[model samples]
Target chain A: MSDLPKILHVEDDPDIREIALMALEVVGGLDVVQCASGAEALERAPGIAPDLLLLDVMMPGMSGDETLTALRKVPQFSETPAIFMTAKAQHSEVDRLKELGALDVITKPFDPMTLADQIISIWQER
Target chain B: MSQGSESYLVSLLGPATAGAVVSLAILLMIGLLARSALGHRRQLRKIREQEDDLALQRKAVDMHAMVKITGVDGRILYANDNLIQTIGYSVEELRGRYASDVFLDEDPRIAAEMWETLRRGDAWTGDNKLRRRHGTAIWVKTTAIPKMGRNGTLDKVITVYTDITDAKLRQQEGPLRAMFDRLQDEVYIFSVDDLRLHYLNKRARASLGWERLNYRSHFLSETTSTFDEARFRERVAPLLAGEVEAVIYESSLSGRPVEINLQLDESVVGEPRFVAVVRDISQRKQVEQARAAFVATVTHELRAPMTSIKGAMKLVASGATGPIPDKPAQMIDLALRNVDRLLLLINDLLDLEKLDNAQTEIRRDPVNLAELIDDAIAHNMGYAQEYGVTFTALPAMPSTLQIVGDRDRLMQVLTNLMSNAAKFSEVGGVVEVGLEDRGDEARITVTDHGIGIPEEAQSRLFERFVQAETAEHKKRKGTGLGLSIVKSIVERHGGRVDFFSIPGEGTTFVIDLPKASDEMSRAA
Candidate 1:
């Protein structure tokens, strides 16, 4: 409830991270918290309790699917809205993402300027 | 009357004495003539004896005992009918011919020694292979003797040759025995009728730990513990009747496992024989057992985690726990992509495992190489377009270059290479694809003008999960298993891949493959 929407951005790449941050904060006019790895995202989720979460599809150590599995174990994140940023945007791939409880898939090399707006529209529709 | 008779007797006696003188003169002349006639008759008889001796000598020279007579000069003075026939020459042709000409071999020292002995009125005897008039070699035993004068001087040499081709053939058996002794594989020749060993090679003897004569010492039952003599005979009698191509028996001899492959020797008539090759396969059996166990263990371990993870992902994605909100939705999306990546990784790992287990099966068919290239290009064109990279194929490339392969797999290989090219290329950079039709093969090449891979990285580029280690490579990301999988698929299709690249310039990957035929046509 702060009138501003809260968003979580989980990405392994630094460039992708900075771009996603600027897109949410300045362009989409939302409050954003960024994490470098899937483990960090899981750790910060309980404290931050963001309204929407944006995640990169691939990372070392723990994968996004595994991290999401861990997140679903927490009560507060049981029905949170989520989207994935990935380089693969084939229809079969998107269908699989949908099967994993994702609202939509945002293909990577995303126009960082309009990323947060795209997420907001998706969220408001839900 | 007595005085008149006495006077007449004296007159008669004087006349008789004159008459006796005349008779004596005449008798002496006749005796002289008779002596001359007797001497002439004796001379004529000597001439007739000489003529008879010459006729006998000529007849002896014509006889079939392989014979050759030489003079002091070692030149052939006489060659018999048999020697001429065996040496394929006429007596007239051989006479005055050097005796060495008929000898298959003339060792210089032996020839010289022969002449030296014959010069001292001695004889020589030896067996040799003499060259026939037609240049065929014939084995012969020859004897040369020098005929001496009353003064002990060498007059002539008499040589006779006895054909010994059979003995020469027997001499050839020695090398064959030596060859059989040197054989590494077990070889046994048994009389078909008696079912007894006629010949056994050294390897066969050593394996059975028996001598040549002991080959028939033991029956099949002694070596084959699995079956007794009656049963063994029953199983093999049909094979000897030409009912089967071979008889395979795995048995243990002296507690050591042996694999025996018995094949009938059909070379001889009126009798059937067998050739058995025995090999020890105990070690191979042990290794196979160990490998089977390993596969079973690994499959069990991998299946559990995979089932749980996949089932959970499916359930969550299906929204089993009601609807998803905005924040968790993003997390789920990433999870799903990673899951897909994991699935692909698992599939690749399983393929590698199958390769390790020697269970990889390649399904080959006729594929159009040029068409496969098009399909691969089409598959990656969308991704390439996103990067603003133009993939241009040269016009020289044919529309359909045919070769034998697994179609889908080959497409996967080409798509992987193209994917790598598209991912690594800079925005607006040109990627050129080329194809060439060699006689029985086709060559495909992809050239990219983006940041080229380093030589060191190129070496390990086709290794699993190995990515380029350059700054530009980091910008364009991938799973890094593309090249490795591509290489495996290409190699499985019986092809090879090689690439050339200069760091900061460009890279080119070339694939060479055999041409494939159409499925229907191939089956036909």
Candidate 2:
């Protein structure tokens, strides 16, 4: 909410998580705190206050929307903006995630180099 | 009474015998008068008894239910008291009003057909829907008898009706049970209180092995091969509680797959029942599971790996890993392009599968065809430019064309057609998308001045997995499912698609759709 610094990211798959970290940290040089599941995200939310929330939808236990819902209950992250990364690539799915109040939806198999620019562009447009 | 005739008779007769002859004549006249009086009395008595008999018959008929007399023209001439009380109309209000207008439906054909039967000297008996005072419709069992006049012409028709609305609402009755017994699918009638079987159709009897078991004593929980009493009760609890009319589920019966629909027969009082209809669904389940598995594999299994593979390939191809040699880089480009093609194939498979099994609902919203055509041409212009072809939308159509269809699906249809045309068109040639205002139907045309379809393959072009064997076969890239998807979407909208082609000359693909207003009118 304040600046383009810290991001709280949650995804179930380790490979996608590694790629996302490479895309965001190594390439874009943005600070981020990552978690494996929604429960872990909840556990880390009170300690690390991130500017934005990046999440992967269609997880095993809780979906990205549910993670956002759980995090919004925290006082520090109540109004934090969220973006979702999804492998189920359908335009309707994007619309649905947007309806759940995501700032933007990035479809799967995305180009890693431009992933940072897409998020930054979205932030600027908003 | 003639005086002259009497005097002539007296003169003719001898004066001495005149007194005796006159006395005999007076006695004969008195006897004739008494006999005439007796005859009159007997005839009057007979007439009075016949009138009494008719009055009794009329009273008995009136007490039965509503009764009305109509003229040959079907105008109410008289109505009984029961009729007046039941339909909320007085004798004066009903008299001379066409029976069709007062009691029958608004359709004149029903009245005409009923009268046609009556005039042919046959009684009309059927269930009739009668409108009450506040426009509520009630069902009635009606019997109309035709009365004839002395001149042998149809004089009037007397109709008798009894209220059958309650019975009609309780649709499960003796007559319907008889029909249920003859059904091809298995049927079971069971008591709701005890869950004991009451009746079973022949199919149910044959398949249930009725050699030694007493069907009447059998319980639902004990009948099916994989009977789960707790699960079945949980499923049917809503119906028993009146929350729903029926509950349906698929389970194995006699170790075979079946779909059972159970409905509570609460309409009958004192003895509540359940009607369960079972259908064998082994074949359907097989087909459904196969389709579902394929889609699941494509979406869940292949998609995750494809994401990693394609992304890694793209990062490598773009030299994000490091600066690679020219030869290997070109091959990486080829691999990336083919990966993209595989992704496209996955998407096409998804779309076609959804359309095939009716996973997507084709909406009937009114859409402007002309605007959609223009949008499709604009959207595909970049793709067309890749083929050295220019996509063009014709000038304003003569009239605005509107149709009932799913706008996105229709766009998919139009875009597919335009791209197909653009792909095969000659280099630097123009491909046009146009709309035509057919009166009852809206027409969309996609025309290309490229190598047209061959006469032989043209007939099967729209079939799935079928493609034209063009000279540049390797050049045209597709999943061979685009035209079939187009056909599927168009058909779902109650429309048709066809093409006119001359090989090496040109091809024009046309899609005809029912206009929105026309579809609405047809539904009405």
Candidate 3:
């Protein structure tokens, strides 16, 4: 793990992606490569070789967990650490996501200012 | 003793000889008269003793059972006090009325069967559903015996019955029988000895395509797609042996998926029966799948845009992008508050729906009471500050006190309570939270110095959409679902929540949760 890890962020909504770009790159001072969907992330995974995966669940092409399952087939991203952001509030759902080998689950309507720090803390813990 | 008969005797014979013969005749007559008096005295004594015995037997029978005697022509000759009281009819009203008319609910089928049994001279002993004077119906375990006259003529019929209404309720067709008849699930009761169904609710009959009024001849095997008497008996072996209370089976019945839960009813000694409730789950499965899809869509679709909207407003409000003017900042703060409020309402509504639908599974684990309290206080501190109120924890004894509950749900309960206290408290008032360790239970209290709830509002305070109408409470503008959620969460964990409120003074909410048993704690 690096002091500030390079990240691959996938979200369907462009506004959410823009907010994350500002929060991570400008505010938290980290290099973040953004993709609009799981398919785009899969296409770019070989080139990015990111240290961490930031995925948004409930996306268009494939869910965040489903995408993680797919990317694990590639040796480059097989051992990559991932964290999921979800709007689903059920504890059981959260537990299910955790069982899929994610670092942690962050609930939606999150504090934008603290998003970068939350990722960094989880990354360090991993 | 007539003198004329004595004088005739004297004239017929000589005086001395007549006198001697008359004396002998008088002695014979007096001796016969004395013997007749003795016989009368003995008969009187026997009659009094017999009357006493019959009265005692009548009193004993009338105390416990209802008796009715009908003439050979079917007219009621007598109805005892117990029968009159139980049927709610006067003696005059019942006399001369046909027993079937008063007791058989006007069902010709049952009446015909009963009369046939009596005419055949076979005693009819079974459960009879009879209507009372007020049209309220009850079940009586009846036994009818016919008295035979000389030359095989029918003299009369004496019927005795005991009210088995409570016992019959296990079949789900008693006092609420009309409602039971309207149920969606099929209910069947069969004797354990012979697996022959004696009763079927209306739904059961309709679904089984059996429009015939009698279900007594139908066996449990007939209702299933795979009819095997031995296999059916084997399946309910546990319930029959009393090893388990019920047998829950999921199988296809006539190509329809059904859940059959059968329990043994041993209320009638020597006549154990099985009460089976069958529900068609094919329709339920489709409905459940659709409901699950809708809930997921609503949860995802509603939260997605709201997440973006809140994030943007929060970023701007924080001045993370750039410096903002004071008025726009205030406006943004207001928008942010309402956004949070809307989110809270959505979360509360989802939780309520989950609880109502029995979708929320409460996980039981050992939770430290003091630690949970500390966490709740920390979580609600920001909200308390918004109300200019402070939350203080009154230290709990045996801070290591433990309870059996779901940690997340317990946290939710405490957070709701603490936040509610903060919201309703007077500005700068201190809301006290405490936990006490009783022997087998833990007592939790959250007290607030606020505008106390009125007496009338307290009764329905935990109901959905009910909030105190006080100006202070109104200004706080809560979703009014917090306490209800709190109560629901606590109750789901097998705990109780109550409050004592004095208007214009303050309110204190106390929760009592059972402590985790030693075995439970160790096992967990």
TM-score, chain B, model 3, is 0.54
- List the candidate 3 regions with Cα displacement exceeding 4 Å: B1-184, B188-274, B281-288, B388-390, B393-403, B436-442, B514-524
Using TM-score as the measure, which candidate wins? 3
Question: On lDDT, who's better, 1 or 3?
Answer: 3
Mind giving the per-residue lDDT tens digits that candidate 3 earns over B1-524?
56887788779886788889888988999999999999999999999999999999989988989999999888999999988987788899889998667755446787678778887788888887777775556788888898878868778999898888757765654555577688899888887777888778899999888877577777877876687777788888878688788898777888888889999876543356788899999977677667666777877787787878888888888887899999999999999989998998988887776665444568878999898888888888897888899988996456889987899888888888887888777889999999998787899999998888878789999999899787766887689888889988888887899999998788999999989988788867
DockQ of 2: 0.35
DockQ of all models, two decimals each: 0.01, 0.35, 0.50
Each candidate's interface RMSD: 16.5, 2.4, 1.5
Best by DockQ: 3
Candidate 1 local lDDT, B1-524, one digit each (tens): 25575466557777677556556767998999999999999999999999999988867755745777777677888766677666677777777878676545667887778778877877887766677664446666667778987888887888777667546644754586578678665666665455566566787677767764565555443444464656657667768678678888777766767677788865422234566666676786577567655644454345334434544444445454357777787787788677667756755665455444433445556677677777777777886877888787767687777777667677777777776777777888888888998876689999988788977787788888888777778777676777777787777776899999987778899998876645433852
Clashing pairs in 2: none
Arrange candidates by lDDT, highest first: which order?
3, 2, 1
Candidate 2's C-alpha lDDT? 0.80
Best of the two (2, 3) by TM-score: 3
Better of 1 and 3 by DockQ: 3
Q: Pick the candidate with the highest lDDT.
A: 3
Mind sharing the TM-score for model 2?
A: 0.61
